[model samples]
Target: MTTDELIAPGTTGPATPTRRGSLRPLLLRLHFYLGVFVGPFIFVAAFSGLLYIFTPQLERAIYAHELTVPVGQAKQPLNDQVQAAQRALPDATMVRVRPGDADEATTQVIFSRSDLAPSHWLTAYVDPYTSQVRGTLETYGSSQAGPVRTWIDELHRGLHLGDFGRLYSELAASWLWVVVLGGLVLWWGRRRPAKGKGRRRLLSWHATTGTWVAIVLLFLSATGLTWSQYAGDTITDLRAALSWQTPTLPAASGHGGHGAHSEHAGPSGPAVAATADQVRNIARRAGLDGPIEIAVPSEPGAAHVVKQIRTEWPTKVDSAAIDATTGQVLATLRFDDYPLGAKLARWGIDAHMGVLFGLPNQIVLAAVCVAVLALIVWGYRMWWHRRPTKGGFGVGRPFPRGAWRSVPTPVLIGLIAVTAVLAWYLPVLGVSLIGFLLVDSAVGWAKGGPAVPARR
Candidate 1:
């Protein structure tokens, strides 16, 4: 029979001779199962993602005073700034020093103190010239920024489980691709519902919103996955590109052999604190604009690393690394210095946050967010509409006979496999989904069929 003859009139699509079979049902089944499994993560990611999108505004609102310092005269040398910061925060490790600027003229020396977990960490900002403490912000709910950012971070990861949390976030991020693709399939079914009728209107609404959201969802899913999967390796590559080398520690000296042991003891010693002019010149020669952060050498023979986030208007980016004892710029790196892969990694964050300026990008992201929200609502509606009249939890449709009957089982199996992979990375989420999977399987078996209708 012809394709048109096979398709019943006023139906959604042109019908096939038999039915669209093979991997389609299996894929749809997996999609549904995984969606239910990762539903909470998607919800959290969406909510937290919305918050993160406006983080700059959040910072401005919450930490107004802390983010600003009084304008002042010339600041002290880099060495003096480090000393001043150390004096105020004796036990803290001085990471880097940010120089003075026009509006916020005070120099800030950042120091961090480690605790049980890195989240239990603190950043101290010290003024250089006056040797006074400016302010401090902790990683989790510091005064500068409150519990909002903290909560967002926790939700973004896995509630402060540290490495495990990051792993969970990564898995969620990776599997988001499935959510985007499933959403597309579901969207495809929404178009041209019924001629000049309410069903058609609803379907048209869904289709329009879905089309807009599909693009942005794909954009975020792709970039977010890349960010989670490759950010660390990209950072490592960037560090390597800057020619950072770790000198091997000397072998333990025999009790009597001081002279031979001294040969491999390393570089002569850390040089005396350099002058302000020398430091400034070093920064200038290194091509760093805005504030340059100088990290004090912790021990003898250690090279000082000058780090800086160049926040000049229109170019809010970063640059950094090790310098020679004589103030000669040794290894260095700019944001532009990143290799193609690393550059893509940096761009991913900008894209994920919709900060890339052009109107099209912003409009697309906003539309995507709206689309996701609609999908969540409509998907729930579809589930509600399909509820069984016979008091069973299965979808309100019959399973197609023959091969289609076997589709849901294998789809369930594939979903389980995908869930297993996702869970291995995010233990808590994995465990939670396992519980969900069991309940889902129990309900499916009790109902004696797949929950949703299979297209025939």
Candidate 2:
């Protein structure tokens, strides 16, 4: 046995297949299991990605008046817009007013308070010059676009289960390792290559496809998992490195010296109100094109923040901070400003958004979604191919079968029943399974059932 005695081969003992290192096998198994277990979530991510790619464009097309204004009229003052929005929602706390672009006709205002029905609200389509409200938009529940975005965002994160969602996403990402491994297995298994040499051109195509996808897959999983868990930590570390902190800038330390002294300030959270006027001026000077959001800092020694949602394609929009009491710029960060871990997460998000490489990236990801759907079909095909042809139930081999057999049917049925009940009770698992079953049903119908042949 020591000398490979099991391979009783006079025909040159089956050329020893390349044995990889420990990390390789472990990574391979992890990928496989994660992909299998988190298939449903992955599908959701992929499908949503396909839809989200054109979100901006789609919104523009559908909500023209709300998003933009006609050119040539008198422009509205930001302060006036805030006043009008406040009058309409007197109970709400005024957040910020957004100035329109060249083509935008209406000024947008947002108001929020903890006591409000939805807790957060956005209102727009007000004529800035007249300070008259044209439309009232309520965000919450199934009735509003806000809810739609929130739900989609939740699906993108973890389908709404906070920690459970995070855990599931992380676990699913771990499975991507297996998908990569299985992909490699299928590739390598297809053609046995000679050692220390390149593969054939045709084989190379398949190999590289698997290789490229695996690389991106690893990037997506690692970054995504880290982001779901430690984005705050990652950002905090980056901020510390950049030395963004504040109690208040001494009157003597004014704007000119602000940048140099940024490091001396200790840990600052976010501030509640930095002057809106000063923030607008800072953002405009930096050439930011969109409306700015000033986040009120909740902690002591925090920076007042402004978020600019850029209309630019591909790159990240930025959030800049200014000291509320001091009127000094604290920090500015786009998605790119994140640390390695967070940057990885941002890249994954961009990739998931199908905007990482622009139009080509979107097409590639959509294709991947289609491929995933096909793999599911192919997996079932492989499973069926190995199944006994007699159509009788069989049992005891490890995997669960829909066609129960050998052991007591009642026992198996009961087990499935109880397990399903538990699964349904667990929201994340339940939602994921429902998602998969819907996809599965579509695939099954498309492929035709046991009695029907696939259509040409």
Candidate 3:
């Protein structure tokens, strides 16, 4: 993703005074190696992502009984809906409630008891107008993905393999930008026309498609890495350092973040119960409205944090903290108050997941996925086309060895410096690139030199 344009494709690189170094050869080699090694993971990500993108619709359809309801003459108090859910799941303890602001949608009363795992919650869907419990379903994650969508999510995220499977996604996210950027640079500098036939035609289509979709790919890669295991930690740290972390309501101690706030801790003593209706009223007065979630306070003095969850454009995600005992507004945070980095992170993630602009976002994401899939296939086909037909069993001609030799000294130094910085910033990419270079160097050493000396 770094460095200026290098030599164009198919010229004797760096042989003339006007020309610069043959960085394209090195890029080609890196791109080739990364493509050959990491492309499958990227392909799987795209393929599964294609399926995952449409899952919101799939989930809505699949859970229509629980997610939707008929319009009624008048809506009951929010407590009535919460009571219906509590009656349905008597053994469970209600944790939060997401009211169906729209007439057709059902209110969701989520519960997490002592016996239930932290990651899983039983949600009772109640018709807000009728105060009738529609059904209960187990949902996960902050978005509250249900069974079907969660399964699809797991398939895309980790192949249902837990922590180990996450590595595949992390690797894909880590390498995707480099591949996209490298391919784009190669396509741009090569200056191939879109008019030729056979392999040429395929090449033109591949380059054109890749160039067009590069923006989305780059965005996806960046956002995806922010969710990655290793890179996410680093990114979170960086965000904290930059003071761009998501803003939260003031903590009771005034020193903790949302998750660490004492207000969220277990009951400290005999506590007053705060009804969903009471919390909703308090939250509504604070300016949060439309599909808001009210986190049931654990204790009387606990602050019941109600957050607006609508992610689509005109996103209303402001939140307020209300004292459960006094029912007074403790604090509030507006979406408009979020730092630039925090806002970008929020929008980028939502857009990546096809939630930012709803249907239009999904369409764009699906198109990007299709483009990525096509590019991978076309790349392999081009590789196969370049194979020595007359020779026994070898793929494309490997770009000439020692392509880095043609790069000018200063440019090479700058490239190395940029690479080192990137490596540190992106650990996975850095480590893998260093490993690839080590392997390439070792092979060259075994073949008899520090680097295979190739002429331009």
Candidate 4:
């Protein structure tokens, strides 16, 4: 759809007053407060995300000895690499093994312990060719991010403040689309002088930058919402109800249970009668190949899970559960057979994480982040310039009140209805929007309430 379709039309004429309109004034107020208040959280998320996207290369340089090895004539067995990792961390429960498919890349054997934070584990990097354990590091999340990326990721996800801190990001994500769409509508709905300085210039930059990156911002906001605490949980429940979640191979015995190893995401299953390499070979023969991970069963009766890890476009995430004892493939789930929603979710997530197109994906993500940052900067500049300065000192004056009074009865009702439904789907957005309105109203009341609309 075109940008015009994505945005509702607003008052169109010279930026100067042609008629008093409710929608544009209300949008201006909402947009202003969102940028002034929630903007910092968004700034942090964007800046950290920008840094996190490029950490794959940063990690390689910083941990070369652990991440890479001298090329050998041929690689050793996955079992050998797992053994080396086992020697290094005998006490930890084995989670999964990632056999670095690249010539000089090291095999990564991930282990989990009760002491580690949820979804955080120890990853022992081993030389596949030498069966030597290079080193171990605490990795985070499904992507197995190293220290540098993990630090930035933690900042982006929750500012390293844990669960409570996550609210900030969720709040930012929840409001981002409104900010984006509102900015688009406002920018497009009105006309500005061909040339101006100060507030006008800032407005031009902010609107143009926001419009240019509008799609990316919306995508980022939506995808990022899926990772939030409140909204994410709600969306997850909705997905499960619709069976839109990514399909998984059943455990060896067909029994299902999660949490055996948080990172693996495979159900509890029957005991394995074979090694990781054997199961991996089984999956390979079944047509799964290219950068795969083998999750060792944590609980007895759990089968080995071999799944493709490549997240690039045309995702190769086909997974299989193997009964190593019987050498039988218990179950298989192919990307092609995934439900439509699941497929889109996968692609959206991969693109959001900057792995869908490799380097180009990273570049685009970085550019979008810079654009967002610039918009925030320019927004504040506009707000600053718009502040009352009579006597050379005053606070910023918000858009005149009573703008909502000009809204048509049907349009206002429709807007409220749409917002309510969206709030149900995205609770954070609803909660924050209410909170802003109440606070703004209270402050205005305390200051003698909204001023009477001025006549042109």
Per-candidate clash tally: 1, 15, 0, 5
Q: In model 2, where do residues sit more than 4 Å from their true spots?
A: 1-38, 61-65, 115-125, 128-130, 136-145, 160-167, 189-212, 227-279, 286-291, 295-304, 311-348, 355-360, 391-456
The lDDT of each candidate is 0.51, 0.49, 0.77, 0.78
lDDT at position 287, candidate 3: 84
Candidate 2: count of backbone clashes, pairs at least 3 residues apart or interchain: 15
Question: What CA RMSD would you report for each candidate?
Answer: 8.6, 13.5, 4.3, 4.9
What's the true lDDT of residue 367 in model 4? 97
- Give the Cα-based TM-score of candidate 2 against the true structure: 0.58
Question: Candidate 3, TM-score vs. the true structure?
Answer: 0.88
Q: What is the per-residue lDDT of model 2 for residues 263-363, given as tens digits with 9 covering 90 to 100?
A: 22222322222355566777666555464554444445555555564423554356666665666666666655545554444556567656567777767
- Looking at candidate 1, what is the lDDT of residue 92? 58
> Can you write out model 1's per-residue Cα lDDT over 1-456, one digit (the tens) per residue?
211222233342224433343444434445545555565566566766765656655765776555556655756555675566556666655444556654564555544454413434344555655556676666442112334566675666565675666655665665666667755665554323333433334445655676666666766766665435344344355546764322221221121111211122222223324544465567667776665655445454455555454322243344333344566555555565545655554555567765665445555665666566666665444434444445555542311223344345667577668767656654444565567658756866887954343444
Candidate 3 C-alpha lDDT tens digits along 1-456: 111122222332332222235567677777878878898999999999999999989988989999999898888888777877877877776667888888899988877655544566788999988899988998877788899888888888888888789888988999999998988877777634545565567778888898999999999998999878888889999999999998777743242123422222332222112366787888888888778987765544567778899989987899888775588887888999999999999998899899999999999999999999998998788667666565477676555567687677888899999988888888878888888889877977897854344444
Question: What would the TM-scores of all predictions be?
Answer: 0.67, 0.58, 0.88, 0.90
lDDT of candidate 4 at residue 178, scale 0 to 100: 90
Who wins the lDDT comparison? 4
**Winner by lDDT between candidate 4 and candidate 1:** 4
In candidate 1, residue 453 scores what lDDT? 38
Candidate 3 accuracy as lDDT: 0.77
Q: Which stretches of candidate 4 lie over 4 Å from their true place?
A: 1-22, 192-194, 252-258, 263-274, 454-456
RMSD of 4: 4.9
**lDDT rank, highest first?**
4, 3, 1, 2
RMSD in angstroms, candidate 2?
A: 13.5
